[model samples]
Target: MKSRKTRVLAVLLVLSLLGAACSKSSDTKEKKKTEDTDYEKHSMETKESTEETTTETTEPSQRDTSVRPVSTPTPTPEPIPMLTAADIQSMNNNNALIVYNEVGNVSTIVGRFFHRPVADEDDAINAIKGVQELLGLQTGYFPFAVYGERFQGYTVYTYQQMKEDVTVTNATLKIVLDQEGYPCMLQSSLASNLDYTPSSPTITEKDAEEIVLNNMGSGYRVLSEYTMTTVYTDYAKAQHCYQVYTNSLIDNASFDMPYIVHFISLDGEYINAYPTAFLPTDPFADYGQDSYFKDMVPTDYSFTINVNGNQVDITIPISKNNVDGKYYLCDPDRKIIVADYYSFEFKGQLKFDTQDDPNSFDAAHMVNYYYYTQAYDFYKEFNIESTDGFGMPILILDGYCDESGRAIKNCCNMGIQYGWSVFAATDGYSFGHSLDLVGHEYTHGVTFYSKQGVQYYNEYGAINEAYSDIMGNIMEMYMGETSDTEWAIGERSGDECRSMSYPYKHYQPMYVGDLYYISTSPLSYLSGLDDKGGVHDNSSLLSHMCYYLYMNGMSLEDLTWFFLASIEMQTPNADYDDFYAIFVASARMTGHEEIIPLLSDYWESTGLKGPREQTAENTTLEGYERINIPFYSAKVGAYCVVEVYSVALGGRYLYTTMQWDGIATFLAPADGTWFLIGITEFSDASLSTKVSEKWLNHDLTAWTDDPNDLGYIVFESGKITTFPTYQ
Candidate 1:
């Protein structure tokens, strides 16, 4: 019902994290930090399976009063014996369980407990062990937690098939079985024929950490252990006999590097790491090419501006690469590649000019804005120089058509891009209409650039889609949408596409357990456009998780930081688990452990689980306060928009609302006074209001007449002012 269209819209009117009703301390005082906040009853426990995420919670809302409760942890069920290899043979019905399936050269195995009287985890362990013995994987390295609940539902477990723990070139293993003890499938893969050896680590854990830190050159906090029961070695490479585990941090504030791994040699030598920083130096720097026309957006320098008469350097070099041609390519600027698909009109005589094709003219606008906005977000949001943190020029193949368009299918509506560097979009008339959607595509360029590349079919493919959705929605939330917009893709449909808050409302799952099918085939990817390997659809899982975190007080800046910083920790085909483990480690590195509970709760709500896990259950955001900002205009029915931004974790647009009621009420992001302003107008351009005594004339005194009072905000003549209450 919220999909009901609003005739008028407003934008960029913003207030500080705490809305109108809040008053400043007027005196310095420290705030409290929590190892665990009393967030009981607020965690997302969804009551309905059909609920939408944007308007839903993860945990259920109502209790089933009819059900009996004699709480005793259900007596831990009865203890069952761990089975042996011979025990599994007695149960095998000669089913051809799927062997290891290779994904990006990483093999995975699957099995199902198809028999009646279901078996438990112990039985599953015995079955998998026997199966592995049959496949001759005993010599290979299995996961340290072979019996851990790696996957949800039907007693599934996964172990990485490491060719060599040191310089791993290939790894894979996964098994799915039910309680019935029937083996469903088993998968494992490794491409390297390189010999591997298990060795004893001579280097002390403390020494190895120091060696890795010294070789890597800063921006890392190390874990205590060598991260192994025994030393792991990749005999294929020069570096062998090393310790492998995610980097941990005791103090995380200054932590800012991407690689989640450290391959430390047992002999105190440096082998190889998973991701080296993607800080490719700018190649467009002067190598004796100084050709500047007028208004050229520099791909290489910072533009200076006087903010409140204070010189503030903002980096935005307007491009002189705006050439009116069949397709203008930024040559010397190798990082930026703009392929104008075509700009011709069929009006009697053929024309190759963009002016002739009105749509084509719009295309140029869309792509240019794409570059500009993305540059702004990457830099301003995460201090990321460009699409690639290393400042890679965005590659855009634009002017892709709408009605009967030809080119990449997923790139158009689903935001599912296929190629690396190259990004595609229909002119503003088709797909590029939504600024955030275009931002979404270009962000894929960032992710691809960061991942070095991405897979477009499996979970990696799904992650690609999810990242696009996450960034796109953020752009739309804080930067794009005038009013509260649905976390949907493209500019075409209304309330008809994927929903972020309520993915279920749009027929998508918010967790891995809800995946469409366990086994997959090429048909899933090749099945015409939208459902590419269920990439677009299944992506709602991560997207929903992303949105949930944002809703539960995770600022855009932190989310962006969490995302951008966590990139190097991923494989070309990383899944939710990969994200989970790395996120916990990285959050600790950044000293954001307080929010880990929030992140962990959302992750588990979606059926993914991990350690140092924190839970955030904001059923109704109970503890957070609110300010009902009031507004007035000589112009009746003037759309009033408000944005509440939080600076606690760097600046982030935490809440927004647009209405004709001349009022916008919002949950204060923190415990303090909030500032209100309209940074931009409906035209989507900055609406500047100089900061002076006149701007601060609005009332900020809090009403303490009632002990059980929240707060209120009022605006006058376009400036924020206090007014009367409604309650």
Candidate 2:
């Protein structure tokens, strides 16, 4: 019955691909933003590279005359450019998939194209460059770095540019491949004419600082809390300007708090560089002198001294940074404060006051040790310095829930990349104090912030949660003392570890294909069932596999397998299929091909076979009602774009259209929630792409007769979804 079901779905997948190919291809605006500037913020997309456009499904027999499995995963893939005359005919109808209104200074190609899966990514890239050549555009003009790809049928590649060690905004490229792995449809943007002569800064750093201080409103006017200044060029409103980076004490409780970036125009006007987002980490922080010293990791100052009439040695931790001569990194966003349930009236953190409660000292001491040490371990091991790889501080809100900023006895005992910081709860010193737990929580931040983290939330989100758990298990195995050695996550908080070796022992699924296996709508899982749709519950499957590999034979190279996988595949909305392929690909790249057999054994044991060939239009799917979102903004024009995506993993691209008077209606592919992405200019990487790819391609200030030379109109939707804004 399963094979029959597979066959039926496979046939439908092929038909949908064919019908999509046959239709005149309308394209998505190419908006590639790189990860360089993105900190531990809202991670990347469900934008799987080269997503095959889903067409209205046809009856099984009435579709393609040829009947073949659309997405088949054999031990050895047949690398064929499966193109027919029909495919070419479809390609002609959808030649230019990208829609440019000749307004924004970006270029992209998005639509259907013929392709064959190449054995290596380098080959696939070359195939894409071939397409660019055919389009009569200079290959160098479209600056992008391919961040993701699907190796199976209909490979899609997502690319963003990171030039000069900074993220480019307003430029992106997405190339779609046919069943044979050839470029068919492409959606991308490249800056056509840019001014990159490093225009002399008309303002000084002091002047910029004064501008920032003057413009900062009440509740933010305390001048002493601001420290650490950095100067860089910022391009957000489609213009180049200088920017200042600093940490401001958001709350008076402590000094040296969260990070913020203030922009200054050459004319000394203060610019809110990132109006709708958190400021990125230091632009110059990617490289630094390496020191293999433990001191490199922040540690609590310990001392034996007579204070309050007693000689005692005390070492404690709470959010503190040089408060009365002790160090603690507190929340910079000032969102986390003392919780209500905790015993003490937690006004400020546990300062270096001997009168402070002993329990307070212990909680602070232990949690900080775990948080800081594990953070150091990530840098020493995988070269990720901070959560977002830009030295963003690990914001540990002890005895407080990150979301609520109040102390609930056992509130939110996990690690999260909240507002570009690792917001962790002290949880009255339970899992919050455990080394493995801290590692587990912090690892979640790393995974969410990693380049591969673009696919951070749904199935990949489950993978995100699982990666943290696995790391916790791995850390305990490699670094834990004999008494503490155990392969479980939230061990201290739950009083037992979720068994990695025998997950079912903990009432968790040990295999992927279990009756309880979850693959869609992560929110439903979180909202409906336990363990948030098996994020922690189902992680046991992957964790068990990791433990088996460790018990058998695993090395740093083996452990770093996931790290490499994440950096390369940042598909924001990834799923089981995307994960398996990426895992296998990472294994192959890291010379751990010997582990492939184990992967097949373990993954197949759970019933997960890469990505299933199914359409978003599957009526058989539960809650499968289709809805249309009418997007009408009075302020949108040729320069504007409207994109709607499934809010789950694989970030299913639902629809992309242009609005004249800000009204672009989208016929959603499937049910559940959809994210509406409206772009005047898009993505984090496109900013740099504009300067480097277009403006600096030849140091030319201007180009003529560009299609992207258009303008915008105000857009509004009845749904009121979150989107990037141009203020």
Query: Among these predicted structures, which one has the highest TM-score?
Result: 2
TM per prediction:
0.39, 0.43
- The lDDT per prediction is 0.38, 0.37
lDDT by residue (60-119, candidate 1, tens digit) is 112111332122111124444443323433344322212112222212222232233234
Residues 1-727 of candidate 2: C-alpha lDDT, one tens digit per residue: 0000001111211211100111111242221111001001111111133443332223222323344233312223334344332343355453322322223211222333434455433354555444443333342332333323332233445544322222333233445454444454444333333324335657755666676655543233322222122222221122344455443322311101133444456567654432101233222221121111112223344445332244535343334433443333332222122222122112322222222332344444344444455544544354444554334434344454222354343322222222224343444545454555666655655554433212222343466556766775565555542143346655544456567766766666655423234333312221222232345556665667677777668763457554444333333333454344445544543446577677667655665543221221111322233222222343222222333333454453532232222333332323344333333322221121111111101112222223354222122322322222222
Off by over 4 Å in 2: 1-128, 131-365, 402-406, 409-420, 452-457, 482-486, 492-494, 513-515, 522-532, 561-568, 610-727
The TM-score, computed over Cα atoms with residue i paired to residue i, of candidate 1 is 0.39
Off by over 4 Å in 1: 1-192, 195-338, 342-360, 363-372, 375-381, 401-420, 491-496, 512-530, 609-727
Count clashes in each candidate, considering only residues at least 3 apart in sequence or on different chains.
Answer: 58, 86
